[model samples]
Target: MGADRVGSGRGRVGRTGAYAVCGAVLLAGCASMPDSGDLRGVESTARQDTQVRVFAMPPHENASPSEIVQGFLEALTSDDTNYETARKYLTTAAGHTWRPELSTTVLEDAPETNAEPVGSREEGEEFVFSMSGSKVATVDAQQSYVPVTGAYSRPVHLTKNHEDGQWRIDALPQGVVMGKSDFQRNYMSVNKYFFASDAEAGQSPQPAAVADPVYVRRRVEPMTQMVRSVLKGPTKWLGPVVRSSFPTGTALQAEGDALAPDDQNKLTVPLNARAARVGQGRCEEMAAQVLFTLQNLTPAVDEVELRSGGKQLCSLTEGSHADAVAALTSAQEPDYLYFVDGDHRLVRLSAGSGDTKAEPAPGALGEGEKALRTVAVSRDEHTAAGVRLDGKALYVGALVSGGSLGDPVLRSEGKTEENRLTAPSWDVRGDLWVADRDPANPRLLLLEKGAGEPVEVETSGLDGRVRAVRVAADGVRIALVVEKDSRRSLLIGRIERGGKTDGRPTVTVRELRSATPELEEVTAMSWAGDSRLVVVGREEGGVQQMRYVQSDGSAPEEQAPTALPGVEEIAACQDDQTPLVANSEDGIVRLPAGAQWRKVTEGTAPVYPG
Candidate 1:
């Protein structure tokens, strides 16, 4: 969120009304308080080039206490190295103790500073001032950030220095707070990838890289900071599901690691002796983790060399076999959009051919007695999992011409039919995820392809009903629609997979967080991209609407497409560029690239291969 609009001439970025403490009485001993309103000369930087970094302007000679306070607050938004210039308005002791890196509270708009007199300003005495703003998010000391709703207030104490008659702040908050615009201008959003704990393992392994997005200082050794953040492990929210290839307590060398890439795009990472002690296999995994993490930089590092004690331990290139981790796990554009037709047959529309014709998928599944209520295709587009029309049984079968549907792979034990199985989603690993909402035995199950018993995954702290489930292509995160106390929440939880316990896959969920708190009800949702979800829901007493929200619960202000009439279900791939498919009451509709929704066929549930 940015500044609120004030008038038609000034544009949307307006001055924030704030409260502040003024300087000593200019005429007498009585200091005057500045009005929160009518404070002028604070212009918007909207017309300025956003790409250029804005540095804090230095305080002029012989500035008053109020002027010094206002200038200091404005300087907090600039790209001052170590905030050295910003500290010019603070006393020597306060400047040394004030740490701008402790936290960053992003505000909704430009904050106003009101200079109110605290008490009788006896000459050469201490003065106090306070500042506040409506916050959007707060990034903590550990760099764990979360979207929040509330106000942020803090007080600063200033005193006259004995060396000169100048006033300087002696005490203040530990960190700096800035507006969203400045945060965007000074900080860059970057993602560091880590391997899923149970990523695919075989002769030719393909481990999925889960992205953890964080904001780092834009120009101040960003590449170095990115590497340091990776060493710090995943963010708080994603730490539970993902694991670092580096051993516990592993980190970049403390004294000399600056992480600058050489001219040929090769980055030599200096690790402690601990990393060099690992075996070759473990070393390669660590290299893969570093390669994927550092590649997100603008001047991408193409190769990584790990060294310890001045000796090379391992080296990796972008083409290394262990580096086959897919960046964004979206489906390769397929030729068809498959669903169940009105005749209870598995049918597909020729989406790739730009044709509106519907045809049967293949042999038994297309023309058999087992009618599918909902279906999900694997990333390879060869296998599919379907739930029966009665929602009691699930079948896994091939999608080719002569493939036959298998017997019930999973059966619901719900006491009532309405509490049966939901749509099944297939990850790139070929594992199927579905929820059995039998109130008595409600559980989320993961079925590995070609496996017998579906492994029941436990969801700790999820008290209500699990209505719908969608697994991301990475296979490490799952989206859930949970209903509790008549309130529905769209939550994203990390998939904790315990590798092959007793020759069987074991899984659980942790770090559940709501993605869309503004919506009162989440009717349907699908993964639109790696870190975003296209959600369809309604506010209290509002009509059904469609909006895209980040999995981290930070709602962007993008305008959403209007809801389709009588829409029942929606499906999308992890690529935001891909078209969206939805099932309306009359028929299935397709939102092709840059086009409006058009009727595809008469169907109920539409899905793309994960």
Candidate 2:
């Protein structure tokens, strides 16, 4: 529906500038001035150009009530510097009180408006507008936005004054309403990184960066808004898992000051004195947070400088410890796709495999007696976790030389074997996540590398059993395949970590939002990007196929990519740019970038580092 590029809006500035220089200029020969000077007749064409953009203005003063209503709705889709033109159709009092920034309601298509001339339009009239086709998501007051699904309706009240028969809206909804295509053109998604509390709460060995994606106004000062959002802290769903390094009261030293990249691509941010008290370690952490957030913008910033009270308190470069923190946590694609072979042993297929032969992994687990049903590899590729075929046990061991698969790390406590456990997922912090799924004691558990017992994660509002669980690379959000009402639905739950008094960390999950409400059954899903997932399911009457859906249940205009035939299982990492791998009936197939899926002979339970 719109340009499919992520940062296409920024390209318009250069194109607009070129047009201003060539077309927006008036010829010097056409200029005439009353002067007696000799140069008056000999006109030199001096270059004088200014950027000009056409804007939608308010309706005429004598316009009918319906005309004014239509003009107002069209203006809502424009940026127009704080929606200045859109307010023209509103009464002076209403214009001053209405805030279009509070939230934005995304509609399926253009709204249908009908005006009812109440009492001959003397006492004023009302216009009712109804829109259909799913309402996707709402951006809240704090700019925290989540995916949602529903229908929406609103009414506009118009009044006519005696002096000038000008029809203007007196009251309406507080925020702006637009369609999905317009929202994509006017808004952008950005991920702001915050430090996970695992290390702080004694759960992990060190700190890791967690990414939280939010939509911001694309034409507005997005870099400034991104930094301000980071200082404001993570969204409500993510607040429990991550903590901002900036102090609580820390804010921009100058209000509305945007962080612009210098010639060196370094962003200098001026913060209040509240951040100056932190030591060098915390200062770097604060800088890392800003760098990771702002780097998502167009022409990404390579480094960050934190300033306070007009002095440079700290300057962090891209290769520094803070800049490297995020890279350390995210999973990178390995050279091989590791899985189990028909011999009940661990094996891998090389990236450039001309032959069909598969090689055994360099570890004892590859040659162990236990038959693995499912396997999950850690981000570092140094360790692997596997669940027994019977689902009664989980084993974790090393993937390097001199490493051996030892005793089962966790045993299922379910009364029956089928109710034992689901596949295990590993987070960046070297912790494993699994679901017991036992009807007797159905719950989620987290296993730290060296902890004595698996910590039970509190899951609220979970109606059905968690059939499958996958932790995002950020370690904040989790995707669960929940079986409820004899069907499966994809739900996204936030992971919250709390500090306990006994020096142990407490983890809980809250507000499980459905990502595929229209689908009657979702068989499998994997994280394709930071805020998106590729799900295999049946939507209403549609057949079971792989579709790309947002993490918040919102749908994009572009159709889903072609489904891989006969694929029973799929695997993708957090980085959406990488190719997707699937377990097909023929063999393991890999989808390269812009290429068809090709079969890689002989493997089961294929997995990428997550």
Index of the highest-lDDT prediction: 1
Tens-digit lDDT string for candidate 2 (80-173):
6578888888889999999997898876554545444556443454433332345767877666566667767677778776567677889888
lDDT (C-alpha, whole model) for all candidates: 0.70, 0.68
> What lDDT is reached at residue 322 by model 1?
41
Model 1's alpha-carbon lDDT is: 0.70
| Every model's TM-score | 0.81, 0.83
CA error at residue 470 for candidate 2, angstroms = 0.8
- Which has the greatest TM-score? 2
**C-alpha lDDT of candidate 2 relative to the true structure:** 0.68
